[model samples]
Every structure is written in C-alpha cells, then in structure tokens.
Target chain A: MAIFVNADTKVIVQGLTGGQGKYHGLRNQAYGTQVVGGVTPGKGGTDVEGIPVFNSVAEAVAATGATASFIAVPPKAASAAILEAAAAGIGFIVCITEGIPAQDEAKVYNTLVRDYPNTRLLGPNCPGIISPGKCNIGITAGEIAELPSASGPNVGIVSRSGTLTYQALYELKQRGIGVSTCVGIGGDPVPGTNFIDCLKEFQADPETHAIIMIGEIGGSAEEEAAEFIKANVTKPMSAYIAGVTAPEGKKMGHAGAITSGGKGTAQGKMDALRAAGVKVGLNPTEAGDLMAEIVATLK
Target chain B: MDLFEYQGKQYFARYDIPVSPGDVAYTVDEAVAAAEMAGYPVVVKAQVQVGGRGKAGGIKLADNADEVRLHAGNILGMDIKGHLVKRVWVEHASDISKEYYASYSLDRAAKKHLLMLSAEGGVEIETVAVENPDAIVLLHIDPVDGISLDVARDAAVRAKIDAEAVEGVADMLVKLYRCFTEGDCDLAEINPLILRPDGGVHALDAKVSLDNNAGFRHPEWEAFRATEELDEREQLARTHDLQYIGLDGTVGIIANGAGLAMSTLDVVNQVGGTAANFLDIGGGANADMMAAALGVINFDENVKSIFINIFGGITRGEEVAKGIVEAMGRVELRAPIVIRLDGTNAEQGREILANAGIPESKLTSKPTMLEAARAAVALANGN
Candidate 1:
C-alpha cells in the first residue's frame, strides 16, 4: 500500500473560503482525495460549491470524521491552524502556505511533538504529498503522477525542494517509471516532517520498489538522512543535492536553502550520500535518470 | 537578519538579559562621545556582521576620548572580509575572571530547541565542537514545558561551570532562553558569557539572528532593517520582490523555484559558463514579475546572455511563456535570452513562444534543460 495517504483518507480544507485554499482544495477533490469538509471561522454551515464548510476543525472532524487536513491559511495564522488540526485529532496535516516565520514553525513543531504525538505535520511551505492514482494532497499537480502499471516501476520519492520534486517525477515519468508516492518536505528551516520521517515510511511500503530523494543546501538533514540510509534503507536509492555552485552565506530563495559559515554546503551533502552507498546525481536530470536505471533493474 | 553588537545588546536588554552598556556610533566624533558616555577605558568594536573582527584589527581598547577617536577613525570605513565597517560600537570594558559559552538555536534534526553551554568560550563555537565536544552541555528543550530555573541550573552545573558563578550563570541562562523563544530569535548567542571578579555573570558579546518571518510582531526591527547594506543587484531585486543573489559571472540566470534556480546555476557552470546572479521568481512567474526580474538582471553589466529556465508545477507553463514574451517588449534587452521551458502545459507554452513573432535573435527556446544551458553558454561566449 502507499504511505501516509490513500483513496480512503477523508480530508478537510482549512481556509477554504480563501483564494488559495479553495483553488487547491477543489483541485484535490477533483483528484479524488475525499475532500469531506472545509474550515472557516465565520463561514460555518456553508459549502464551497459541494464541500461542506464548518466553523472550526473540531466541528469538521466531528461531523465528517475527516482524518486529514489541508491547511491554506495565511503564513501568520498557519501555526494556529496546524495546532487546531492537531488538537482536533487530524492524523495527517499538509500546510501549503509559504513565508511563515521560522520561529513560528519551531514553536509549532515542539508543541505538536509534546501534545499530539500521533499528529504528523507535513509542511508549512511545501508542495505536499501525492500517491499517484490513489490520492492527491496540497499543490502537486495530480495529472503529472502515474499509477503502478505493467510498463512502469512504482518508486517512492521524497524531497525538500518543490519544483525539483515535480522535475524528478516528470523525469521518471518520461522514462515510463511511475511513483508510488511523492512527498515534498518543504524548504523551511524547521519543517514538521523531515527526510528521515518520510524515509522510514517509504522503506516499509511494499509497493515502493525504489526511492528518489532531492535535497538542497542548508541544514544537516540530508547528511543525517545519508547516515540513516546507510543502516536502514535496503531499497535502491538515487539522490540529488542542489546548490553545488552556490557560494557561502547567500540564501538561495528557500529559508533552509543556504550555505552559512561554510556549513551545509552542497558538496558536503553529496559526499555524505556517496559514502552511504547512494548514487548521487550531479544535477536534477542526472539524478532522475539514475533512479530510472535502478527501476529498470528492479523489475 | 543578524543584529550588530549594539543592536544585539539592546535586543537582549528587552528580555532582561544582561549585556555590556554600549551605543552605536556612525562617525568618529559620535564614537568619541559614546566612549565618553560609556566611561573611560571603553572598547571600540566594528559593527560588521562578519566574525574575526578582533583579528582584523577592527576591535581595540580606548582609554580616553583621543584614543577613541583614533580607533573609531581607523575602524570606520575599513573593509573586513568584504564588509565595510560603517559604524562602531563603544562599550565599557569589563574585568573577566572566567569565560563561558551559551546559546539557543533550532536543532532541525531533533525538532526541538537546542541549548549549548560550554565552559570554553571567547572563540568560535565550531572549534569547541570539534576539539572538546564533551565540554559543551547540549540540552533539548520542549517549547510546551519551557525552561525553568532548575533546568538551567542543572545544565550549568553539568557544563562544568565554576561553582561560585553557577547560580548567576543559570539565572542568565533562563533569561537567555526567553530571548531565544519569546523574542522570536533564530539564534541568541552569548560568546564568552563572562564571570567577573565579583562573581557576576555578564554577556561580553551578543550574536543574535532575528527570524525575518516574525517581522509582523517586531515593529522596532525596522531600525535594524534600515541599516542593512545591499549591493547594486541586490538592491534592485529587492524593489521587484524577487529572490536574487548577485554573483561574479557572465550569464544572468532566472528560474522558478529555489532548487531549480540553483540547479540552473550549476548546469550553467557545468557547461563552462558562470551565472551572474541567482534569481527565483517563486510562484509568481507572471508578466509583471518577469519584467521586474529581467530589469534587475539587465542592470548588471557583467551579464552577457540571459538564461530563463522555467519548470512549472503550481506555476503554469503558458502563463510564464506569455510573461516572457510580454516582458521582452516592456524592457529593452542588452543580452540575448535562452529559455528552457517545460513542465505543466509546457507544450502550449512552447506553441506560444513559436508564434509570438519575437525574432530568434532576441529569444531562443531549447527542447531540454541541458540544451538550453549549452545554448546560453554558447551564446554567452559569442560562439
């Protein structure tokens, strides 16, 4: 079975009254993600087209029994919305809003771990997760994903970068390789779910034959993930670390994507992955192709 | 947003964390007056963000106003590690009996607040980490329970802090932890948290990085924001709300998503061309943002050819194509552009470019990212 999400997962959209929330929320519904309800404080007892709207996450959870949440609230209120979802016992939460301050996420992360250990938060600035043909969450285009088939191998993917996740999927799709699940962990400095968390799930999934990981500069997450891969993951994996040519001390768009004081360099991450028996790709396409080779050998 | 020494002290003061009494001076005369106000035998330190200022001769002691003027005049306008010192912090000197280290930063792997306390201080913490890892006491604090006096005291004692100064250091540690959490600081570091001859713990240096995302809550942060130094390209990009980092190269690069932009830079470099800047349009690859990004890159004279790489996800391909075609009309280009357009509805995007009537001399589209990189590099070399 696919990890984190499947066809049976009931989902609620937080801030469904807003522009982004409504758009991606409805899009996810179209992809058959079982979008059960929406949450907007003042706009309760209403429905966005067909989806029921509620005053709070607790009401939405109680009424529809929605087990997952898609949060599209503004960055300032993102943490509060996430905490609300966790409090209401939404097992999985996906936040698509970017630009939430790092401190807000750090505090929210600690709160989630302490109070709601069962609640798994995906991202505050990520593309969210996609299990092709089965379910779609967040902003990842469902049309780009391919299901398990006779002609393609079902590989699992996890990445820190948004568009690079899409690139990896597209790269493999062109080569007739399908993905069992694609998870974008986001580029925020303090993400709720990291590489190790996602890797653990992918490793246990029987349908996921190979793994494709995309990481960028900044933080020791990738280096740590490399260490985890060496001991745990038996599946063939290919990885790509962006920002090989990026200079020191420059924040390259993402809050977490930067080389500060000679730490978190792309070369350092690449070296760590290579030493861990991971086939590290020099660039995005090379990384995708390397994964394709593993898939071909798998089936 | 790294706070200067004076600003860091002021930030620490808000949380009742003790820091040296200091004032920031922009001129030599202001520095002399600040020195006089701080009392005799003051220290004049450069207000640059980079470290190793003491080794760079940017820090010195001034026992009198004349010495203050001399030190300030020498340090001001002096370049240390590519950063020009426009201001100096004047503070009263302290007699230190012992030096220690204490800080709070996010441990991403642990998903908790990392408290690092060490008896060894007044130097780079990285060195202490490599040389004597056990000398540093690492504590992971949960934001829910928070840090109490007992927790701070326990960590202080375990860190091998001097027994006489343990209480004072622990008290300061509690306050420092508040500055890290409640203050919305990404990192609140006190290097050489000094134990004075009187057995008092004082912050000799404050290195703080305020979380930029928490700007909505901190209005006073504008004072620090105003003094941020920006170069030509950086300043221009700021006006457009585009993420751009200026680099020393010839091929000006623009792409959607941070990862793609960085990978674009790597691909350009791999093909034997250097990128002049790193520009990520994010989700807004629309007409207005594209023109704004193009204007910023064209402002750089070193740019020989522009590489516009777009891999659409939530960012639509046709919209980016129309933006590029429309942006090309608004701004006069100095360098030819090579576009590697793919992803969602990319076929429609390619169709729009082919029929746009924009001559090939100005815009050239490639089939793949690799081909586009090669084309951009080749065009940059005038081949």
Candidate 2:
C-alpha cells in the first residue's frame, strides 16, 4: 500500500518524442511501470519504443485510460504541459524538466490548487517518485532501489535533492530495509509539493512504519516540515540536512539551496528537527543507520 | 540576478511606471553632463547591489556642476559595505510630499505571490515587519487571476495610505504587478514610492531581482549577464560550465549532485578539515566532464588535496571510474586525489581503478565517504 502509485497505476509520457522523454520512458517501462502511451504534438500516429503516441493528452487519456503522467518537455513548454495534463484529468503528474521559470511554476501551481484540486503535481525540476518493486516514474535509476523485503515495505523516504534520494534508498537497502515509496519533491524554490505534503501521505500509508527525510539549507521548508511532524506525524522519523558549513549568500548548485540573510541555516533546521523528537544524522550514512534502528524496533 | 538601481529603473520605465529621469555614469565628467541634461538639483547615487548605500554616504545631493563633480569623484571607487562603487545614477531630485513602500515577491510557504504594502516607507521593510507587523498590509495574489482593481485598492487602504494617494497608489500597484510578471522578476520592489507636491506618485527607487531560470523567455537579459563580476576561479568554472564555489581551505571537494556536494563539505569539516571549494559535476560524470572539473580544482592554489565523491544512480560507477582514470591522463595535478566510489556496479569500478596502475602517492581510493573524508583531510593537513 504505497502512496500515490502502485502496481495498477497506468502512466503516460508527455513530450515522449524528445530525447530525454524517450530515454526515461523506456527506463520506466523496463522497471515494470505500465507506460501505456505518449503525447507529442505533431507525431500522433507514430510509436516511441512500442508505446502509442497521441497528439494531445486528452486523446492519449481517452485511448489508454492512463492515470498518471511524466513530463519531460523543455522549460519553456513545461507549464503548458502540466496544465494540459491537469485539464485532461490525470490524477498524478511528475515534471522532470529543470529551469522552468519560477513565474511559470507559480501560475501552474495556482491553477492546480484552485481549478484542479484532485490532481497532485510532484516536481518541475526533480527526479520524480518510485514505489519500489511496483512502479517507477520520472528519472530515478530503477536498479538502485531493492525489491521489497518479505516483511513488506516498512520505511517511507522523501527528499528535495535527486541523488540524495537514491543515496538514502540504497543505504536503507543495505540495512535490509525496504521502502514503501520515495518522493523527490525537487530543489526548486517553488516546488509543486513540500515535505509536509509527502509526510501527510506517509502517515496515512499503513505499510510505512517509519520515514527518512533528506533536506538541505535554503528556504524554511525543512523547518516547516519539523513543525508539521511534531503536530501530526505519529511515525518515527530520521532526518539529515546538508550544507552545515556552506557559506551564506552563495547558491550551492541547486536553485533553492542557498542560505539567505541569517535564515534557513543548516543548524537551524537540525535544531528544529531535534526539537520535534526526530533523530538527526550529520550525514547520509548516519541518517540511514538511525532509520534502520527505528525500523528494527518496529514490531 | 540582482539588478542595480539604474537597471531596475530601466525595467520600471518599460512598464510605464513613473520614475525620476536618471542616467548612469561611470566617471565624474559623465555625471556632470548627465546632471546638466537632467537640470539640477540632481542626486548622485552610487550604483552598488548591496543595501545601506545612503548610510554609507554613497548618496549625495548636488545643486550645481561643481558639487556634482565633487560628489561623483568621492562616490566613485568608494567601498560601500565591501561592494565597490563602479558607477553612479544621476537623476533630477523630486519634491517628496509622502513616502510609501510596495513590492511583489513569491511566498514559498503559501505557494503564491505575496504583495507587501506599507504607508511607513523610506526605511527597512524588515524592521517594519518585525516591529509593527500590522502596519504592513500583506496580500496573496493568485497567479492566474492576478490582482483586481478592487483588490489593489483594498491593499492601498489597508496600508493606511492617504485618501488622495490611494487611487494613484493602486494604479502604481497594478503597473508594478505587470512589471513583475512580464519582466519575470522574483522581486520587484519600490522602497519609497513617493508622492509629489503636485499630487503625482512616482517610483523614487527600484530594487529588482530577475529569475535566472526565465532567461530563455527574455533574451535581453544577456545585458545583465555581461555586467556580472566574477572572481578568477569563479570565471574559470563558469567557462567550464561547472557549478563551483571558491573558499579559503585546503581540501578541494567534488561530487555528482548538489546535495551530496554540500554533504561532502560538511563531512570534510566534521573531520577537522576545511573545503577549498564546492564543485558539483552534476549527473553526467563522463571523461570530458571529469577532466574539466579536475582542471578547475587544480587551478586553486589553496587546495592541498582533492576528494572525488561519486554515488552513481543514472551515472554508473564503472563509467565514473573510467572517467577519473581518463581525466588523470589529461591534466597534471598539484594536489593528491582521493576517490570514493559507490552505487551501481561499484565493485567493478573499484577493480578498474585498482588495475589502472596509478601511483599510490598521487592517487588513493576509499570505500566510504567518512573514510575518504578523513584520508583527504589528513593528506591536506600534510600528515
């Protein structure tokens, strides 16, 4: 019982004719995702790697009855693609394109909240989500996440950065722990989802007994997540925040990973998570070990 | 992508928002000429991105050509809060009747656009937000619906703006919103949206920050990029298309992702070693990319040792190992290198590295991030 996606979830690819779309679409298909069809504006009659192509999302949805979508269009076309998917009534959408202007994301997000309340948008610049051994969406390498343990998936993982998401999952796998689902909400300043949003889902999933959250400096999202965890979450959580020694006012690669004017420091996030009764690890391996301990005690 | 005062004013003018007539000048002679054209009494304002220009005496009033020359001479080449003044904006001074504050920015928590308006202007908005929170009227605008005339008017009234100035303020707000959206700006701010003696409202100062992600839509932003000032190492990294930040330490750290790169820095510090720089080679760590990254790190004289931490997901460990070996042949290094390889065929990658026949004095490998950090730190400290 993973959140958002599972074995029966059928998916569609947007901009599937493009290089990135075709590459990851095949990968998602190989990972056992039911990638039914793809959408390309001009090449409607063609098929990409044995997947049927339609000119519009509506056509693809009607033809294949796909419930989820993966967007791999360029930055300029990303907002329109997301809106089209939402308008077509796709329940879940994950956008993997980076460098979409913040203004475009803001507009798309506002529309999603006000007009299409049912649709859940995952990322505009992220690696996307995966429910291990069931389904894979977006560009997370499918091989790293181990198959579910015989006890069923016990831990849920959420992160802002892509590689760290893979790192956390790999570490947990080494400890003989399997995941219910892992979501990379992205490192953009205005992401479609936040830490709290994923936390809420993890709490509701009966299969997820504990959670691991990977955060970094910049924005108050981590601090806000800590507040939500203290109030709502009953599941034990372990956390790690990167960039403790990162200098202020300099962007650390990721668009959203910057320490501003004494706020959004790593120390601040570490303190907030600790106050929420979550064990905070100084690094990735340490955090995975802490979560492994929590999973070990879950009878 | 922070715009200087002159550039911000230029952007405001594009939206037909009222701003004082101003021209940028790099020299005192140009300042005097601009003052003559604008018809003094003029204001000589230093062009620097940092705040507190006034408190630092970067702003001065010049009633004549001689005063303009004197002030401009003093202000140019002056250091204002560690930012050197490279230019000045000469403008015709306005007769201010009142001051108000207005700005539009993204509210990450709310996932919406935030509008801030205050009747108490000409001061730090942060101070106002902290001391008298209610004095500043906050409005969340839906991006699709935008701000209606009624909503804009309500914001002005709630800000305690004078009755006569409300209409003009609302009009300015609407124009500012257009500027913010059309201009693809993350922040469009007017510190002192001043009211003139003759019942005219104008933008006295402009502070804008454009989203670099939106560069594709606005090709004109190339002008802004051209004016950017970067240090030697930063310029080199920019040329190589590597995400690198220079620091004053001995260990040069490189990783595949931003989060891992930052974590590498933290782990190095935890092991009693400081990082010379932060470099993210990104997802594709092929031979060419590794060579470019290594070249950039070698240019930093402060670096005594280098750490390459790659946890392959989309990038395979064997490919990374080959890239490192190939890169070693491309560049001669001043600092010893420590490689930590993990994920996706890691054992095969380690075997490849072991059989490369590289000297242990110049190259060493560790299996874990912690051990790699300790080795790099010890080597950097000349242990």
Candidate 3:
C-alpha cells in the first residue's frame, strides 16, 4: 500500500541507451521493478538485457503501456525529457539528473501545473523513491530498504538530501523496521515535488503509520511543510534539518537556499517543525531513533 | 554568479534594457580614464558584491578626474562587510526625478515567475513587501504567456506608478523580463528605475545573478570566472571537481553526499568537536578522488584529525575501502583519520581498511556514524 508506487506499477527508462541510465535501469530490473521498456532517441530498436526499447516516451507508452518513467538524461536534455514524459501522459516521472537550470525547471513545473495536473514529477537532482519489495526506482540501494515488517511497511520517509535518505533507511533497517516509501524530493531551486506533496500522500496511506522527514539548510520548503503537517497529518512524525554546523556565508541565488528575511535557515526550520509537535532529531542517527520511538508506540 | 554592477549593466544592455553607461576600473588611473571617457559628474562605485555600498562610503560622485581618483583610491581597497573591494565601476551619473523598483524572480511557493514592481524604490524591496504591501504590485507571470508591454503597463498602473512614467516603466519591464528569461538569470533587479527630468526611464543600478547551471549554454559567462572569490582550500577542491566548503574547526570531515557531509558536521559538533570542512566525494569514490580530497584537507593547517564517513549507496563499499587504503599511501599524513563504512559492501570496505596494516595511531574504523564521530573528536582533542 505504498503511496505513489507498488508491485504492479509499469516503469520505463527514459535514457536507457546511456551509461548510467542503462546501468541503474538494469539494477532496478534486478530488484524486480517492472522495467517494461527503455527509451533512447536513436537506438530504440535495440534491446538491453531483454527489455523492450522505443525511440520516444509516447512510443513506449503505446507499445508497453508504461505508466511511469525514470529519467537519467544529462542536464542539458533533462528538462526536455521530463516535458516529453509528461506529454506522453506518464503519470509519474522521476528525474535523477542534477544541474538542471533553474529557469527550465520553473517552466517545466508551471507547465505540469497548468497543462498536466495529473502528472507528478519527482526530482531534477534527487535520489528517486523506493517502495521496497514492491518496487524500486532511482538510485537507492535496495538492500538498505527492508521489505514490509509485521506492520506492513509502516514508516514513511521523505527527504531533501539523498545521502541522508539512504542513511535514514539503513538506520531504520538495522532496527528491524521497514519503510512504506522513501522519497528524495531533491534540494534545488524548484523541485517538481516537495515535502508537502509527499506528506499529503503519506498521511492518506493507511499502511504508513509513522513518518520521517529530513531537510537541509536552504529554502522555505521545510518550514512550509511543517505548517502543512501541523493541521493535516495525524501520524507521528520525526524530522532532521541538516547544516546546523554549516558555515555562514553570502548566498547568491534568489531562491532555494536563501531568502531576504531569514526563512531558509536550519534553526528556523527546526523551530518551525518542533512547534508543530514533531520531534526534531539532532542528527541522522537520532532522527532514526525518534522515528523508531514512534513506530514502537504505534501499536 | 552575482555579477558586479558593471557586469549587470552589460547584461542589461544585451537585452536592450536602458542602463547607465559604465566601465569597470581596477586602478585609480583606470577610474579616471573611465570617468574622462563617460564625461563629467560620474559615479565612482565600489565593485564589491555586498550591498549598502553607498552608505558604506564606497560610492561617491566625482565631477572631475581628481575627484574620481580620490574616490576610487578610497573605495578600491576599502573593506565593506568583510569584502575587500579590488575594483570600481565608474559610470556617468543620471539625473533622477523619482525612484522605483522592479525585479524578476521565482515565487517558489506559487511556482511561478514573480515580478515585483513598486513605486517606492531606492530601499530594500523586502521592507516594502512588509510595510506598505499595497504599494507594490506582485504579478505572477505564467512562463508560457510571459510578459508583454500591455500587461506590464497594467501592472504598473495597479502599483500606482505615476501616469507619465508608466509607459517608460512598462517598456523597461518587458526588457527586464527578457533578461531574466532569455539571459538565464536567477534574479534581475533594477533598484532605482529612475524617471529622468526629460521623462525617460533609465536604470540607475543593476543587480543580476546568473544561474550557475545555465553556464553550459552561455559561454560568455566565462568572463565572470575570473571574479570568483574562492579561499585557498576551495580553490584546491575546484581543481579536483570535489564539493568542498571550508569551515573553522579541527576535525576534517569527508562524506559521500551533500546532506551526509552536512549532517556529519552536526554530528561532530554535537559530540563536542567542530568540523574543519564539508567535503562530499559523491557517488564515485576512486583512489584519485579520495587522494585528492585528502590532499585538499591536508592543506588546511587547522585540521587536527580526519573523519571518512562513507555510507555506500551507489558508491560501492569495496571500492571506497580500496580508495581509502590506496589514498592513504598517496598523501602524507598530517592528521589521523577515523573511518565509518556502511551500506553496499561495508563489511568488505572495513576489512580492506583493517587488513591494510595501518597502525591504530594512523587509521581506525568505527561501526557507526556516532562512534566514528566520537573517535574523531577524541583524536582531534589529542585524547
């Protein structure tokens, strides 16, 4: 009962002919994801380890009825790939490519909002989502994420940091706890999906009894998400905001990590989350312990 | 990629936006030459990145070459907010009848291009957003529809811009919008979009921040690379393509992801020690990268010990172990290092480190992030 993905989801690789795309795509297939088809513009006729290949997302959609897309295209072509996936009516698109220009992301985000409301885009720089035994997308190591425990994959995780997401999953696995879904929303100027979006889904999924959210310094996303959780989410939540010890320096960008009036700092986010009745972990290890405490009390 | 005033004016010029004539001067002589070229009553402005230049006395109006030389000499070496000015932008001063504000940026929450226009200018826009919210027109432009002269004029009228200045301001707004979108800028701001005595709209100041990710498309941005201010350790990391941010502490920190590297700093500080730097080796950690990271940290004289915290996700544990072992032999040790390996073949990575025969005084492997942090902190304090 994962929120966005499960055992029955059909997935296609957007840049399957490239080195990283093919490598991780095959690994996802090895993890038992229904990697139905692969898409590469010129060499679509060729197959990669028995997976079907198509030139375009629309072709793959027509050929295999693939509903989801995993995009690993380079930064220059990443926005186009995401737009193409949305245009092809892919319900869920996960972009693992980093370094996408902020303007392109803004355009793509608004396009999805106005033209394609039903389509959901994950990240332009994130480590994708994983539902454990049911499905795995993006780059998270499957072994670190446990299958459904007796409670049925009860803990849900959404993080801005990729490594911290992996760290939290590994920490929870060591405690014999399994995750309902782990989402890496990516820390960027404009993420396709944000902490609030993931929280809404986790709050509704009955299998997800508790949630763990990890954020980093920069952006009002965490603070905004804390506001959303204060009213909407009933499940117990534990959170961590990275960069407490980060050096104070001048910020250049107008968004993401810096705001004029002091909204994106770690202390601001920690204070906001704590005021919302959520336990804020001092470190990644402590973040997992806080979540473990919630899972323990769930029964 | 926040450009200096002169560079920002250059960017505006490319979009056909009206900006003051300006040239950058590295020396007092250059300032005098620029002022002589631009004509009398020029402004000798410091090229430091921080704001409040005028209040800091970094900006001065000079009517002649002698005045230009005096102001340039004072502003060039002056430190404003810890930013030592090394250059000045000497430009012909404009006659302002009124001041207004206009800028283009992302409204992150609304997920749209936020165009902020205000009749109350020559002050911080954030201040206006709070004090007189009605005075500023906050327009959300859909990327598809973009900005046009009519729409800009409509917004100007709503913001209560003076009747005579609306046309000129509207025309400037359309060009500024093009600079933000076509010019690949994260922010393009004209603080005092002045209405001249002649009733012509002119940009008295330009504040532009180009998107770093868009550099691949804009080769012209290479000129700004010379203006990049990096400390010694950061300069070294840039050579190796490693993500490193220098900090003031004793424990040298290295990790695999930006999030983990940052959290590792907090972990170290929580255990009663400060981290010297934040270095993320990313997904592919080979010996060269490990050696390069170690070499860069070794250059920091304040580092008392190093913590190599690798939680292998896409970064294979065995390869990281091998990289660390091999990197140890490459760089001469200035500080002892503690290692914490987890995920994706962590056991093999740890075994490789232990079997490498490095003495406990030099290298020790811990089981978890907490233990590794404690060990590194202890080592840093000479325990």
Query: lDDT values of the candidates?
Result: 0.90, 0.91, 0.88
Which digits, one per residue and each the tens of the lDDT, describe model 2 over residues B25-106?
Answer: 9999999999998888999999998889999999999999999999999999999988999999999999999999999998
DockQ of candidate 2, scored on C-alphas against the true complex (2 decimals)? 0.73
TM-score of chain B of 2: 0.95
DockQ per model, Cα = 0.75, 0.73, 0.61
TM-score of each: 0.96, 0.96, 0.97
By lDDT, rank the candidates, best first. Answer: 2, 1, 3
lDDT, residue B164, model 1: 97
Which candidate tops lDDT?
Answer: 2
User: Model 1: per-residue lDDT, tens digit, B1-383?
Assistant: 88888888999999898877779999999998898788988999999988899999999998998999899999999999999999999999988999999999988777778899999999899999999999999999876677999999999999999999899999999999888877888899999899999888999999999887788888999898887777878988987889999999999999999988999999999989999999999963676788789999999999999999988776778888888887788878899999988776788989998999989998999977888999999989889
- Taking chain A of model 1 alone, its TM-score versus the true chain A equals 0.98
For model 3, what is the alpha-carbon lDDT of residue B273? 97
